[model samples]
Target: MKTPPPSELVAEWPLPPLASLGSTVRAIGIQRELRRHLPWKMRGFLRVDGNQAVLHLPIEEKEAFSAASAKIATAIEEISAYPVLPSEVEDILGISSRERHKWMKQSRLKSAGTRTVKMRGRAKAVTFHVFDAQHIEDILDRDLPTIWRQEDAAMSAENRKRAAAKRRQTRTQARSQSGCAGSADDASGSKLEGWDVFAAEGLLRAPRK
Candidate 1:
């Protein structure tokens, strides 16, 4: 039996009207603020510039987007349909290269592949990775800074504990060696002791002549 091919979605472009684009941009902003509790189809989502927003919509819906509500749907449709790029993710996340690399190493952000581009005057090309928008969005929703800070605090505490333990061990060794000395004059007498014993763990204070 010949298996049929999967059907493609054939919806026409829904270019939103000037007013609708504004609504849609506003809607996207609102949903982001409200943590997406409200549906994106609510009113006034687009930015103040309807011209740019309108371009995001299908050609058909451009004229009919009069009511604020209708435009909200168009805006939602645009975001759902648009191909988000890596640059867009960087802008939306407000992260620098160091932070981005940190996330990539930690597995918070995933890349499709490594990209290489040559500069006009460069001897060699530069290679970099591209990330998916959905993965970036997941980071935003999870509030990565919160997790990063918590992990840092825990690590700092552990380091401090280890440092204190090392200090205590050094102090104990010094006290044991000093109590074993029969006299302060023994410092000059122990020719063999100088060859053994741990390296001075702390600074040695000399006597004033």
Candidate 2:
């Protein structure tokens, strides 16, 4: 068998520190975005090792490597400041979509801006709110999710109590009205029965001789 030549194309770059940010999902997002700039054949060439992103290609594909490298470098520079997508924010904060929307709408989780992107293989565009990365970091650092959950629980308990009290009040009022009606009926019946007996004994007439 003929000896194979050694490969001459290899490029390695460190992923942006903010890319991982203690969240595996965020790191995956970063990788996906970087891959978008690569050709289909080069897509599988990318790999993440610890903090570094490595790319390997055949020597004959040097041009593809250069383009991919440049794009990766640019992404590293800009990705740190990029507004966090909703899914990314949810993963970073360990919150659900409903919670994220609630917090954002209430101004607890501030929105950096809106992002409009066309869905892949679809003609229609979709828009969504994006959040500042630093703001999310601050929120995570402060452990806001736990605090907000506690607050929500307390509010829910208070609401339940109020509802129960209102229901009790309604029942009490209904019973009171029913009891009054029953008492009126009893009094009316007693009065009619007494008058009937008096008439039968001829009490309304003069004493018989």
What is candidate 1's lDDT per residue for 35-149, written digit by digit as tens?
A: 2322355322333233333213233443433343354444555454333334545555665667667767877667767668798999999887865445555666687756875
- Regions of candidate 2 where Cα sits further than 4 Å from its true position: 1-6, 120-124, 193-209
Candidate 2, residue 5: Cα displacement in angstroms equals 8.8
State in Å the error of residue 155, model 1.
Answer: 1.8
Cα-based TM-score, every candidate: 0.44, 0.77
Q: What residue pairs clash in candidate 2, if any at all?
A: none
Model 1 scores a TM of 0.44
lDDT (Cα) of model 2: 0.84
Quote model 2's TM-score.
Answer: 0.77
